[model samples]
Target: MNHFIEKTLQLKDPNITIDTEKVDEVKVNGRFSLIYYGKLSYTPKACECCGIINNAFQVVKNGYRTDSRITLNTISAMPAYLKLKKQRFSCRECG
Candidate 1:
């Protein structure tokens, strides 16, 4: 999965991580569109509310946003657009 994304997006170790629980859809015609339902690979090591840096600060999954961006490369010999529904997170202590 990682290899495919790296090759397709031409990115090395991109911070975006796919959510395997959801199925990714790809549309290919004259142009290519990859609808990846995933999340940003972010782990908060500190709490913004109390300025605490420890595991006690609970990180909660907030929601998600559909981010559509143009890719630099083409897929299947066509221009590719990435539609990523990235999951959001928040600190329980702050919110």
Candidate 2:
């Protein structure tokens, strides 16, 4: 949904760029779904001794529980399915 993508961009910092083409549509219960795939520019800081940034990694998917009753409502009332994609990195500077 355009609205969903717009909302997502609004929530992020202005410096971040979202890749809209990476978004995918999945069929859930015979209904269309929207998925987003993209990466933002991130700066990696190193410790005082070693100044090398760590390697990049792929993102992971996260899921959440939904209210069955609300989800069973009319398709119009049902909200879009959202899967949050995020990555985890370890920094020796902070560790």
Q: Residue 80 in model 1: shift from native, Å?
A: 0.6
lDDT of 2 by residue, 34-92 (tens): 54444334443443345455444222222323312112122334334334433334444
Model 1 over residues 11-86: C-alpha lDDT tens digits?
Answer: 5546766544554445556434544444465566776676666486487667776675535465556555555656
Residue 11, model 2: Cα distance from true site in angstroms: 2.6
Which residue ranges in model 2 land beyond 4 Å of their true spot? Answer: 1-9, 14-16, 44-84, 93-95
How well does each candidate superpose onto the true structure, as a TM-score?
0.56, 0.35
| Candidate 1: regions farther than 4 A off | 18-38, 48-51
Highest lDDT among the candidates is held by which one? 1
Task: For each candidate in the order shown, give its overall lDDT on alpha carbons.
Answer: 0.58, 0.42
Residue 79 miss distance in model 2 (angstroms): 4.5
